[model samples]
Target chain A: DAGVTQSPTHLIKTRGQQVTLRCSPKSGHDTVSWYQQALGQGPQFIFQYYEEEERQRGNFPDRFSGHQFPNYSSELNVNALLLGDSALYLCASSLEAGLTSTDTQYFGPGTRLTVL
Target chain B: AQSVAQPEDQVNVAEGNPLTVKCTYSVSGNPYLFWYVQYPNRGLQFLLKYITGDNLVKGSYGFEAEFNKSQTSFHLKKPSALVSDSALYFCAVRPHGGYSNYQLIWGAGTKLIIKP
Candidate 1:
C-alpha cells in the first residue's frame, strides 16, 4: 500500500502571504494530523482531523488552519506567513481518532516551505 | 501539559557498536510513548511505541525501545549500529486512556551518526 503522500514537496512564499500544503493519508487510514518541523527540531503538533472534523489542536494561533476531506485527504492553510514558518510541514495519518498507546502513526514525506 | 526531552543533540558511534538515544517524558496518567526516525529531507518514520505490557518494544528496522515507567523514560536502542541508521530520532508522548484530544508532545530530536 502507498504510504501517506504530500504535495508540493517544496514551496517558497513571502512574508504576509498565504500558503497551503496538502496531504493524502495512507490507504485505509481516516485520521490526519499536521505538524511543523523546524530545522534541527522535532515535529510539533499543529492539529488533527477525523471524520471531516477538527478533533484537536495545538498551541498554534488562528493563522494556521486545516481541512480533512471525506476521502481522508487533508490541507493545511497558513495565513500571514512569517519567516519562522519556513520549515518542513509534515502530515501523519493513523487508523482512527483515539489510538491506543501502541498505535503507530505513518507520516508523509512533508512539504518544505521556504519564506523569503 | 505533556512534554518530551531528548537530552542529546547529537550522538556519534562507530559501526557495529551498540547505540542508544535517550528520551524522557512527562504527562498526566499513563504515558503513551513513541519513537520515530527521519532521514534528511524526509518525513518521520514510525520506529516503535510503548503502551503497556512489555517494557522492551521492538519495531521496524530492528529498533527497540525500553519503557521505564519509574523513570518516565523511553530510550531507543539497537544492538549494533549501521551507517544507514544515521538519522534524526524523535520521542513523543500522549496521555493514556484519553481521546485524540491529547496532542503528541515531541522532543527537540537527536541526530545519530554512525562512522565506519
Candidate 2:
C-alpha cells in the first residue's frame, strides 16, 4: 500500500506571499496533520484535520490553516509568509479509529519551503 | 516549555556498536509516545510507538523503544548500529486528554552518526 505522499518537494517564495502545500495520507488512514520543522529542531505541530474539519490545532498563528478532503487527502496553506516560515513542512496521517489514544501517525516525505 | 526533551543534540558510535537515543516527556494524562527518523530532506518516518501493553515496542527498520512510565521516558535503541542508520531522530508524545488530545508534542531531535 502507498504511504503518505506530499507534493511540490521544494518551493521558494518571498515574504508576504502565500503558499499551499498538499498531502495524501497512506492507504486506509482517515486523519491528517501538519508539522513544521525548522533547521536543527524537531517538528512543531501545525494542525490536524479529521472528517473534513479541523479537530485540533497547535500554537500557530491565524495565517496557517488546513483542509481535509473526503478522500482523506489534505492541504496546508500559509498566508503572508515570513522569512522565519522557511522550513520543512511534513504531513502525517493516522487512523482516527475508536480512540484517539491508540492512533499512530505515519509521515510523508515533506515539502521544503524557502521564504526569501 | 517543550513537552518532550531530547537532551543530546547528536550521538556518534561505531557501526557495530549498540545505539541509544534518550527521550523524556511530560503530559497531563496517559502518554502516547513515538519515535521517528529523518534522512536528509526526507519526511520523518515512524519508528515505534508505546500506547499500552509491552513497554518495549518494536518498529520498522529494526528499531525498538522502551517506555518507562515511572521515569516518564521513552528511549529508542538498536542492538547494533549501521552506517545507513545515521540520521536525525525525534521523539514525540501525546497525552490521553486535553483540549487537543491527539496532537503530538515533539522534542528538538537528536542526530545519530555511525562511523564505519
Candidate 3:
C-alpha cells in the first residue's frame, strides 16, 4: 500500500535554467496532478495528467509543463526559471474524475525548488 | 471562476480547548469543498471533503468540517486540540466544468497554533 512518492527532496537552479521533478502516484491511483507552493502560501494547481494526456491545467504560463507515464508516474518540468519560481513542487494523485468515485487526492512529500 | 477563502491568517487555541478554522468558497454550481493540513516543510494532507450528502464530514486526526451551503462556508472543527494539531490548514474548491474542472482552487491557508 504505497502512498504517493516524489524524488529529489530538494534542488537548486539558476535563472533561465530548466528543472525536472518526478512523482510516483499512490497505488491504485491513476490520475496525477502538480502544484506549486510559494513561501507562506497555499499550493496552486499546475496541471493534471490522465491516460498519458493532460486533462486540465491552471493559469500557469507556457514555461511549466508535465508528463505522465503509462504506469501513472509523472514529471513536472519548468523552463526558464526565475527567482519567483523558487517554491515547493507538490505531487498529488487521485482517481479518474467523474461522479462514480470519490475525488479525494493524496499527496507526496514534495520537492523544494530553489531558483538561484 | 472558482475560488476559496480562509479569512483567518492564524488561529491560536489552548491545548484541550475546542478549535475552529473558517473557510468560504465562490463557485458557480454545487460546490465541492475540501480541507487539507500541512506540516512544516511537508506536503498537504487530505482532511476531508464535501461532495454531497451529509454536511458534517469527519476525517483524519479527529478533524471534522461542516458544509453550510446557504453561507457558502466549510469550517473545520475539533472537540479538543492537541499540540500536534498545530499546522497550516487550507481550504479548496473543485469546479464543475471547463478544462480546469479537475483542478483545485486553493485558499491562502490558515496557521493553527495549539499552545500546550
Best by lDDT: 3
Tens digits of per-residue lDDT for model 3 on B1-116?
56788999999999999999999988887867899999998888999999899999999999999999899999999999999999999998887643337878899999999999
Best by TM-score: 3
Cα lDDT, model 1, residue B6 = 98
Task: Give model 1's share of reference contacts.
Answer: 0.83
lDDT of 2 by residue, A1-115 (tens): 9999999999999999999999999999999999999998888889989899998888899999988898989999999999999999999999986345487899999999999
Docking class of 1: medium
Q: Tell me the deviation in Å of residue B41 in model 1.
A: 0.8
Any residue pairs clashing in model 3, and if so which?
Answer: none
Superposed model 1: Cα runs more than 4 Å off:
A97-102, B98-100
TM-score of each: 0.96, 0.95, 0.96
Going through the candidates in order, the fraction of native interface contacts each one reproduces equals 0.83, 0.75, 0.71
The sequence of per-residue lDDT tens digits that candidate 3 reaches over residues A1-116 is: 99999999999999999999999999999999999999988889999999999988888999999999999999999999999999999999998756344578899999999988
Q: What is the TM-score of chain A alone in each candidate?
A: 0.96, 0.96, 0.96
Model 2: per-residue lDDT, tens digit, B1-116?
Answer: 53899999999999999999999987767878989898997888888888889899999889999998899899999999999999999999877755556678999999999999
Quick one: best DockQ, which candidate?
A: 2
